[model samples]
Target: MNILITGSTGMVGKNLINHNNAKEYSISGPSSKEINLLDKSKILDWLAKNPTDLIIHCAGLVGGIQANINNQSGFLFNNLQMGINLIDAAYKSGIRNFINLGSSCIYPKNISNEIDESMLLSGKLEETNEGYAIAKISVAKYCQFLSEKGFNYKTIIPCNIYGKYDDFSETGSHMIPGVIARMHKAKINNDNYIEIWGDGKARREFMYAEDLADAIWFCVKNIKQIPKFINVGIGEDFSIKDYYQTISEIVGFKGEFKFNRTKPVGMKRKLICSKIINQLGWMPKFSLNKGISYTYNYYTKEIQN
Candidate 1:
């Protein structure tokens, strides 16, 4: 099988490429420099030449809270355009198998318990990242629309993910990487205190990037018919305080942290309801601590080089 993976250098796409062990499939991952996702002509041309039997669409404009607030239009436009172009191109190319990635942020902001796939679009999105979530929701709807016409598009929604190749930007990264980056920099600079936003009570469920990749591959190889939307995660969560403590220990940061109550905590809790996906016999292999340790080691090596 010939497969094409967009966003090849991204956290999720990189893990997907690295962990794919199916000897029967040939995967092609294209970088942004090679094909601009916003350019429909380029996408069409690339697909015409690539001759892929399957396409894994992981490319998107993504970042943390600050970036999302500052670049709302950019997030919405770029992500929506990319999804529309790729799915249309795949449709034109007659590729039957396509996987669309969605964010758990697509859920409503007030959800504090386990989130099931049925809860999507039931309420308003979190205002901070509403633009990005709208784009993702649109893509999922489009896929659903196309499925009725005989297209085999699968949408997998994952909770907050972290691991190697994550964007560690201090101002524009997700929770795990952002915390690690700040704490690591503080430790390296011999800073005495690391400030955390909120009261450290916000809890989140995070799946390692490799585990998400593994889930995707498992879907590709084992499942005969992928659901319209499925949740992939570890099915458990921990408080922000625990995450900080764990990551700080892994990075050897001895300093304490001060929580700023004025800043946003994003969500109170984000646990994945993995009943459907779990029934498929898919389970995450990495524990929170183990994943953090692995990611910290990679981050340290990266900074030294």
Candidate 2:
């Protein structure tokens, strides 16, 4: 099948493109400069010329907690606009298969339990990333509305992901990559200590990006059987301190970590229920340590050099 993966240069998109099964189909991964999703006309024009049969919508404005807090408006507006434009263009172009990527952040903030797909928007979102969550929820709802009308658009909500091509910048990266970068720098500079935001007690479920790519491909092969919304995750979680310890081990950082209680830790816990996807015969291949090791290796080889 002919497939178009938005945000092809992103960590997730790049992983999907590099998946072994990707060779079985014709896939187009256009850069933002090649096809700007913020513009509807540009999307429609691209579809008109590309003749795509499926779309894996992975494009969005995403970042860590500080970035989310500082750029709430940009996150909401850009993400919402990009999703709407792409989905609308896909509809107009008669494309039936679409796989929209959603984050675990879409679940309510107060729920400390393993989040299921049904609990989406059940309560207030965590204040730190509420804008981004709202945008993701809105787009997922849009896809659901279209799915009810017979289109095969579906949303796959994955937990925190880190792997090759992850954003490891100081202010623009998620927990895993951010920690990796910080710890690596501290190790390199022979810093005696590293500071962690919050009390380092909040829990999170993170999967390797390549594992998410495998799940997406599984969804592609079983598109008709996939639900309107499904959760794809590692079915496990770790405290911030635990993650710090693990990543430190991988990065060979021997420094002590100090916690800053004043920093905003978005949610106390955000672990999603991956029962449906699990039953669908899809499971993540990497453990937390294993994934971090791979990601750290990628960091050293790709980003550090």
Candidate 3:
């Protein structure tokens, strides 16, 4: 099979391309320079020349809460445009199999229970990341609408992901990567403390990027049996403080954490239930400690140096 994966340079895309099973298929991961997802013509032209059998749409403008709040318009417009342009172009190119990656942010905020795939758009999204969430929701719905029309396009909503190739910049990193970066720096500099956003009470579910890649490959092999929209996650969550503490232990940061209550924490909790994917004989293999340790190793070797 011939596969085309977007966001090839990003963490998830890189993991997907590097998966052990990826050797079984011919994979083409186009950088934006090769196929700009925001431009329909470019995507169509690339598809025409490439003749792909499956497209895994993983490209997007994603960031942490502060970044999301600061650039709502960019997040909304860029993500929405990329999704629409790619899916439409794929359809036009007669490509039927597509895997649209969605986020846990698409679920409603402040829910006291684990978010299932059915609860998408059930209520208001978290204010901090609402714009990005809205764009993701729109694109997932577009995939569903097309699926109803006899297309094999499916959306896989994964929880927060962090691993190799993740953005660890101060301004753009997600919770795990940001925390890993900060803790590692603190450990290296012998800093006494590090600042955490909010009260460090917000709960989040994160899966290893490589684990998500495994799930995607499983879905690719069994695309016909996959649901229109499915949730892929570790089926558990931890407090922000738990993540910080875990990373601190891995990075050997024996320091105090100061929580700034004034900062915004997007959702009180955002744990997705992976019952469907689990029942379908797919589950994440990495534990939080193991995943974070691997990610920290990657950071020190790849990003820090």
Candidate 4:
């Protein structure tokens, strides 16, 4: 099988390429410079010229809570265009096997317990990432609609993912990377204390990038065996304060933490139920402590350079 993976330079895409040990498949990961996702003409042209059998659409306009809140329209328009164009072009080019990467944020905001796949679009979405959530929902709906026409496509909704190669910008990175960068910077700068958003009570589920990569590989090989949409995660969660303490310890940050009561904490408890994917014999390997340690080391050595 000849597979094409978009967002090759991203955390998940990079890990996917690295963890793929199968000897039978040929994988190609195109950089943004080589294939601009927003340009539908370029996507179609590339697909026509390059014969690909499978496509793992990982490219999108992704960012953290602050970034999402700041660039709501950009998140919506850019992500929507990318998914719509890539999948449609692939389908037109005779590519049947497709795996679309989605976020758990598509679940309703009022979720107080374990989130199920059936609960999608059941209610309102988190205000902080409503635009991005809407974009993901559109992609899933598109794939679901196309499946009725004999398209072998499905969407995988993964919980909060973090690891090496993640965006660490203060304004653009997700929760884990943002916390790592801030604590690392504060430790080096010898700051007395660091401030965190919200009261540190909300809980979240996290999956390592390498684990997600492995799961994607599993799905591609077993695409025909899986359902139209599935959730891939560790099936566990922790509080914000626990994350702060853990990250601080991993980054060697001794500074005190100050919780900002005014800042927004998107969801009270956003935990996904990975029972379906688990039943398929796929599971995450990295524990939170181990993943944080490995990611922090990577950040200090590679990203800090």
Better of 3 and 4 by TM-score: 3
Give stretches of model 2 more than 4 Å off.
none
The prediction achieving the highest lDDT against the true structure is 2
Estimate TM-scores for all models. 0.96, 0.99, 0.98, 0.97
List, residue by residue over 130-229, the lDDT tens digit for candidate 2.
8899999999999999999999999999999999999999888998999999999999999999999899989989999999999999999999998999
lDDT of 1 at 143: 84
Clashes of each: 0, 0, 0, 0
Judging by TM-score against the true structure, name the best candidate. 2
lDDT of 2 at 184: 95
Better of 1 and 2 by TM-score: 2
lDDT of 3 by residue, 215-287 (tens): 9999999899999999999989999999988988889999899989988887888888899989999978999
Report the C-alpha displacement of residue 230, candidate 2, in angstroms: 0.3
Poorest lDDT segment (10 consecutive residues) of candidate 4: 16-25
- Higher-TM-score candidate among 2 and 4? 2
lDDT of 1 by residue, 75-116 (tens): 999899999988988887788888899999999887877999
For model 1, the run of ten residues with the poorest summed lDDT: 218-227
Estimate the Cα RMSD of every predicted model relative to the unseen true structure. 1.3, 0.8, 0.9, 1.1
Ranking by TM-score: 2, 3, 4, 1
In model 2, the number of clashes is 0
